[model samples]
Target: MAAMYQVITPQKPAAILKGVGPKVAEKLSSIGIETVNDVLFHLPANYENLSVMNLADAENNDKVTVMGTVMTEPAVAYFRGGKNRLTVFMEIDGIYVKVTFFNQPYLKDKLIVGEEARLSGKYLKHKLEINGQRLIYEAGGGFRVTYPMGKVMHSKTFNKIVAEVFGGFSFNYDLPETVKAKYRLLSVREALRLIHFPKSPADIKEGRRTIKFYELFMFQLRLMEKRQKERVRNERYIIDYDIDELKAFIDTLPFGLTGDQKKCTNEICRDLKQNVSMHRLLQGDVGSGKTIVAGIAAYAVKTIGEQTAVMVPTEVLANQHYQSFTDTFEDRLTIAKLTGTTTRKEKMEIVSRLESGEIDLIVGTHALIEDDVLFNRLSLIITDEQHRFGVNQRKRLNDKAHRKNVLYMTATPIPRTLSITTFGDMDVSIIREMPKGRKPVETYWRRYDEVDEVMASIASEVRKGHSAYIVAPLIEESETLDLKNVQEIYHMFLDCFGEEQVELVHGRMKPAEKNEGMGRFERLEKPVLVSTTVIEVGINVPNATYMVIFNAERFGLSTLHQLRGRVGRSDMQSYCALISDPKTENAKQRIDIMTSTTDGFELSEQDLEMRGPGDYFGVRQSGLPEFKVADLAEDYRILEHARLSAIELSGEMREDA
Candidate 1:
């Protein structure tokens, strides 16, 4: 159950426990700020102490709060492109001043001709204009110190305690002096005061430093605890297989497996052939051929007359794997799917086959974990996009394998340092190569208005017997950013090309419908497919040579790359065009780097630096333990320190025990 939040006065803060929240206290509970500790830890995101500066001295257009009177009334005017702008012509002192408030209807009523108020905001002077216009800038600072009007202006509501504190009141909490001293951090009250109404930039920096450290420390502690729990379990599996058969299977492939793929595959096969059960993780980049390697491992167990269960994060991926395995292994393996969409009769047959030891492999979503799906001699369990499953889900799947080997596959590149700490208990293998003959995709970032020209180019390729994928970020329109929906893009393509030219698939579609839609695209029944990221993984359409992503800026670096990876599979030259809006430097940089390089490892490193570890891990959706404070990719130093500390503490605990 979620914790009940309560606010306690300075005199009785300690008396109020988790369950002691009053009715009103429950109503006023701030999201993210749950308990007394949460309230204390809710340090300001930033601080702003308004420094008064003369209009002339404020170079680089710094925001300034200045006393001014409305010398003229605001006029509502509409421009040529239906733009409604409110011009507030203000005159202050002997020198004339003009302020233009854009698109604010009530601004005309709020500031009268004779009214005097402080106009605070960033302003820039137009050199050629007769009158320099001041544009209002929203004040940014800690919530508590901002004025009531300021809070009301932004429609933000805070606790009464916070409101009072912001209003210049102080509170006394029972924080231990020793803890504070040890951390060399400021007191809660002092930190809050400085954060809310900082007098200087240095004060704001200090306040943030103190709180950021605590947050990082707590995050490290949680990761360590989780790591400790996983280490204590005596889990093992052994694999014994004919090495010659594995080698023969590899040799049979039309294309030779890369050295990296072979190395990673050997790592997995080695683990399974061990005395202890293998808990292994396979990390790779998009199109690095992790799935092909997975097939070899699955077959190893199958050869030993044991059933293997492979779990994928999505139905599409499951189906893709099912097809791929069935195609390669043929009648040699009795493979079945147990997804949510699987019919009762189909599921029953799968269950019976599994119980009877007739099924060689099983692929599905969470449905594979159903109580009735009993397995006979289940020796190998594999999961794709391992991050989507929680630790418990992975454990449950592992439990099904009994003493069988467990292999987890990820498309996201894990930072080296994080890989060490998170997968401490699991043997790790990384497949970092694409199959030979795979061409590097040409990536481009362009504006939405360039859609017609891009479409013309894609259509030309389509006429030449090539295929393309037009991907949108969302299936349907949401209240968020104005992005092209799958439905909208699908129709737009049909209108641009023809109704018979394009097909659409999204998560909202039924399983059969989605499969059919994807099949049409894959088989070239439909030359162009417009869809969402539901096609982000495992739906291979090798003939597709053009990949266009709308609102590409909104997608994580890894996801964008993966979407691009869908193409460039065949011998034909492929192009990945990113349809971005008025591009920011960061967005341009990301798209440009992808365009310039085909190295997944290099791209992963750049992704780590640009998007940070959170974005990388978040997109990879690999179910590895996510660190709160430590970026396994970036914060290697902190992770090392925490690891050493954990080692020392564990030794002490063992000695005491």
Candidate 2:
């Protein structure tokens, strides 16, 4: 039966359908609809309630469908900008009203004088006007589903295509009968049909609920299967490190580890000692000292004579980790750095040493995932800024080892919703406590008119032997946006502070130039560095005491937090000035939140609610599955129910197998 269902499924190209030629198919593809299944799943964005309403009872601007007699001839009148309006007189419930259609001249031929018709649109009671777009010469009406592809294809054409497809065949229900009964879900065919053409509002709601649950349920099932596959046990990968040696190493550190850091490190070490493969996600806020925890885990792997690969997102970050690890391990371990800028000869030498087990830890960017880079005994893989890399890239790096033990670290705290859906397969550990003596960054929101006051505060801080960062959203001035750019800020700062004291860095700059600018800022040679959001992640400067972001409303709350993290790394009192004149309510809320609290997790939750899951991390780069119906933010309750159902059904299927 499953085989038959697979064969009968409508996986054919949309062009195979009648009236869907190459041109129409191309238009469909433009909106991500390519196959018959795609067209069926392209659900309506909204539904137009065309239920008849009495003209006397209807309020102003009320959406209504009225059955009335056309009393006057439809006359086309020319408006400004060469636009035309078709107007006619209609008598509904014995009240005459003017019905207007803008730019729809063809309707004049259909709305005949002294004829009966139904018109659906917004009704203006004071003017006795019914501004309408849908004029049907038919008899009955209910709810009209409005597809998202109004610009791609006409509503009538799309409706015809959908009706033809629905009339063509039936869909196979994949969910077991018992499971369907348990969840009170509609079958696939019934749900799709009702969602496309529902008789009542309840039908639309029920159909959408069923589809959303099924989508989330199937997604959870796939994740469970992957989790099962990754649960492979191999005793050879287990590490037995010397506890005394690790403690001694920790004692040698300049500062004591935070409780959260210690707890996470212990969690990671325990995972390494187990026989089963380890897949854990370490979430921490910016400046929470996650690197040292990861460093401790890597050192544990090294103690047992195994190599660890530390992959970071940027070359600058790779260098930072390489230096930190080299400093920490001093003469005890061999560490190497690999990046795109590494010379071919140096890269080959490093690769040879790594293959020969001469190197204990290798820190790199995407260069570490190249096929030629082989490890002698890769036991633990640590990916920093894990969100910046896609799942396939991480998998490629994990494939280098037989028994996979991956530790993914992200400074950007994952929202609770994403932690359950996107990283559901992995175990999670969070480091919420900052290191001792580190002060929280003082955050403030200032209007663009107060730029001079903000600059004065920064100048005062600079005079105290501290450095500052001026971040802008764009590198150059944009014709459309009236926001400040890095170039303009850099020159302005250069005039205030000497050229040698100001440096400019942006994404468009050459890597070497950017690195040089950042290096000068780190050395405090440049007291002020104007940059774009390129400095958002992995650039740590403890001596920097001030962070000023121009057009702060342009950035997400999570991003604003990350940029603020660049400062307050040291014990010195640090400040972050958010300078922007926010216009919209959302923009104003972002600034208020930025000034209110410094908690990354809280800000991330607000960000998820405001921008939704798609833009939380960019949709394409987020490595999350694209659901046809379920939304991770708005449909969280449905997601939870579906997850539980998937777990129960999966267990039953396993028993039967």
Candidate 3:
């Protein structure tokens, strides 16, 4: 096996593997496993430590080993098209359990009738169906590694195939010994072996940690290089305003700034004066007065005789910011808005004014990045809800100026750990403090059976002259819940609250239609607004005090928090009632987290833990590179170590250069 390494290394393709054929190789390639190294590096989504149990003892969603007799022949039924759902009728100590293997028609031949077999899978409670059930020859011993594309092949088969290859494979991507020793990093060989076949749970954990470090370290090094190159080329157009001017501007505002807001403002002000182009991420929870902080930055740019363009995610958000900025500036400077709904003639005029620098500060959506829309001496580009804009869109708008300074504002608050690691390229300024007079939303969790009580509470809030948001989860992705429709729920609300008091909004609604629905709610014409997650970041109404999210299990911790944030924008006592009977532990955790804290940062941290930095916020959307083994949300400490190491390595590279 050791001698095989001399001849067959990672450079070889999957075709050289012991059992891989044309079809198997083709399936493997779909998951980016074309090479032998790819197979070796293919990480597991999760591992299940097999626990042997009888079918009678297995509860719902339990990962238990069932040593059973194949009581019936494996029956395969064609579903939809050429694909098949294979069901194997098995008996564990006279108790029947149905094993389901989706899209694997060939598994029928493997499950022989009238024979004893060992199966490991998640047992669906109430019913005897086992989802993701894998047939194993061994009864029980070690953990089962679940792959990303397990639907195509059995985990047992993958284990055997990889073990044969691992016999010869050597981990070659090792860092310098000095760097490794300084960071207390593991050798690639040990890391890979333990990550794949760990002897203990601690081994799996440490193995994951080491892999995460390697990924983040390399990613940071690459980003540091790009950042260094950018700093050399783009020098900021020096801002004329100082901290004193920013303070004076804030003083005129209708409200006082929180300490966190003030600190963030000072950081942004300091960055504006620097010679290097300032790139910053301003993160605050919803209604945390980040807009006012942004207003100060925009005003500073205006004083410097430069224009600023504020880009937002939605048309409603663009309009809301336009009004907010207009009120804040109060004729101190010029402000304009350009949205997709803007007429052809109005858009032309707005573009003309922008080109002539007539608009001192313009707030708009993606329309601001249009090719024909040119800016005169565009100094600062501030993007609100930074995750909404594409990386190219932001770059395209920023390229219009000679030396562009960008400030990204996000109401989606993240923990400091994620902020540092995810946005390593940008200087981060945090506004953790919510403004005074903003009420903490009272949150509640319930099962679907308690909908009547939630509805009654909404009516009570509405009768008190407060508005309510009826957030319904659209089951678009799930086939099991295809019959369930949010529109049907909207109709139910309409019947209960009257059509005049209820308005519907969803992703499929036309912009005009959706805006009208939210507009009516904002104007107080409608006391109850039924919407999908489409209203996640839209219209902000201070009067809205009741927010009820249906099927809360469908949303992530981060999303649920954001939805809850729609209310509690004002001093009025608000309520966020999360309604769902979550079956899975993960679903229960999300609901639990929401009910526990109104802190966006805390919820985001939990979200990162429960669901690994999913495309929930800016991690994937902001064009930041993703890690293979490292999760900035869970292994944030690892990220910090990698970031520091990368920074040191970057300094050495610069000195050598």
Candidate 4:
């Protein structure tokens, strides 16, 4: 009933194309272009207008393509620094213009006298200079598409290859005809053609719109499919714990839970009560008490004779969580900590206790997912700072138990668009309310020239029996970047304060050394601590009222917020000073946003807009779809439309089936 399949489908190797030798194919493969469809989907980054313009109508600094007759032969003029410039005089629309090409002496023989040529470049009328890069001896002129080819191939050569493939193949459209007609979108073949070789700017715009919609629509469809699969019924642990017991445990805490924390805890408990597996994301701003909420959930799970695994990105955080949980549950639950630095005998004993169900809960780093570390009854898996782990790493941990619940926690408040596109398969719980008696951190932006004033303020705070955290961008000196490093700042602080008063911490240090430095600072024995961004996550010192970040412009707004959250944990009036002399507008804006608002969600939205979704928290590794045409920040409306369309279409297909 079906026709024979063709051998040269879109999935065929791209080396079959003309002018594509083994070397060219290898080069293409380096940039992730390995198939015929890949070559088709490699859209242009921008379009260069090569349409000829009259010299009289062109303005200064305008990128114009002008057709002119060469009045004199091109001559090579030697310049300083062993450089040579090829200058050619041309007559365009009865006006004389000088075209110069620097370090391109070979052009003198190609640009002959009295021959009409087309030159595309910036026109400077004051000096009558046309700094030209493109010189065409041909007749046709239109728009030249520019791609993101980083030394992969020349634009002209790539364009010709794309044209050959375009002319030789046909594409099958993914969208149904009815949907395409309703949306007024071009077919796949036409859209790809126009995107690669457009006649005008409008053609490029139309083609890009169609491609963006297609990319988003397909992505949403895949997400919806995955969601449906995840929703299928599975045998899972039904956690039923005593209400009075959880309440009594909560009562023993030092502080009352906020409304948001209680709400999230209730939501998580409700999910655990069901037999179905739980997959939820717990999003909260820094210092919003996510740890306590997760702790409560884990405590509830443990009541049913089930074990919980709390995994963190760093060993320091693992140790912190282990200590916090042990203190909170004190003799009510048996908790063990495992990390790379754990002694072999200790790890073996912990593993034996875990296998025998003696350990009610275990807090560790990636060591939790080891092969020999088997669990008796693992029900809930909590990953703190979920963005730092890859999808495969999470999956390996999830595979430890059959149909276990996963509660991913992040201190970075993700934007709404990213939350939908990236975590669409999971339900989300947000905790936005801070605990009572917590004061907002007073934020200030200071330039490098104001270092004296900043230091004076920090000194004053330390003199008041409070500690200070000084953060730098780099751990050591970098030849390329001139930003401040931890060692430099450590020495500077040592000069201001004696060696006994200052402690330095960085990632390269051993866990014992880092913990020692942090312990000294936490104990208030060291009034000042100099460190890198490793301190951005854990280590809560309520008495540390001052946070001074050097070269704050090097970090994102969300990072700055997290760093500032290190302080402001207590009722004391805390202050965060951002120190930098930014060289770019974007960097300046990031610093300004940090000083303007303490809301992590608002800063995340601003960050998404400024740095885009891919760079926002490294979403690419966080299970975000790598979109070719659709931008999560700019095309949110289109994303919404595409999502709705996918839902409707899938429902229709289900009914039809």
TM-score of each: 0.67, 0.89, 0.74, 0.88
Following a full C-alpha superposition, what root-mean-square deviation does model 2 have from the true structure? 3.6
**Tens-digit per-residue lDDT, 50-82, candidate 2:** 777788889999888888999999999997898
Cα lDDT of model 3 by residue, 440-473, tens digit: 9999997778889998999999899999888887
lDDT of 1 at 651: 58
Error of 1 at 193 (Å): 16
- lDDT of the structure predicted as candidate 3: 0.79
Candidate 2 vs candidate 3, lDDT winner: 2
Candidate 3 colliding pairs: none
lDDT of 1 at 543: 83
Badly placed stretches (over 4 Å) of model 3 are 1-173, 176-179, 189-209, 233-236, 242-245, 415-417, 475-486, 491-499, 618-628, 631-633, 652-657
Best by TM-score: 2
Worst 10 residues of 3 by lDDT: 1-10
Q: How close is candidate 3 to the true structure, as a TM-score?
A: 0.74
TM-score of 2: 0.89
lDDT of 4 at 274: 80
Among all windows of 10 consecutive residues in model 1, the one with the lowest summed lDDT is 1-10
Kindly give the number of clashing pairs for every candidate: 8, 0, 0, 0
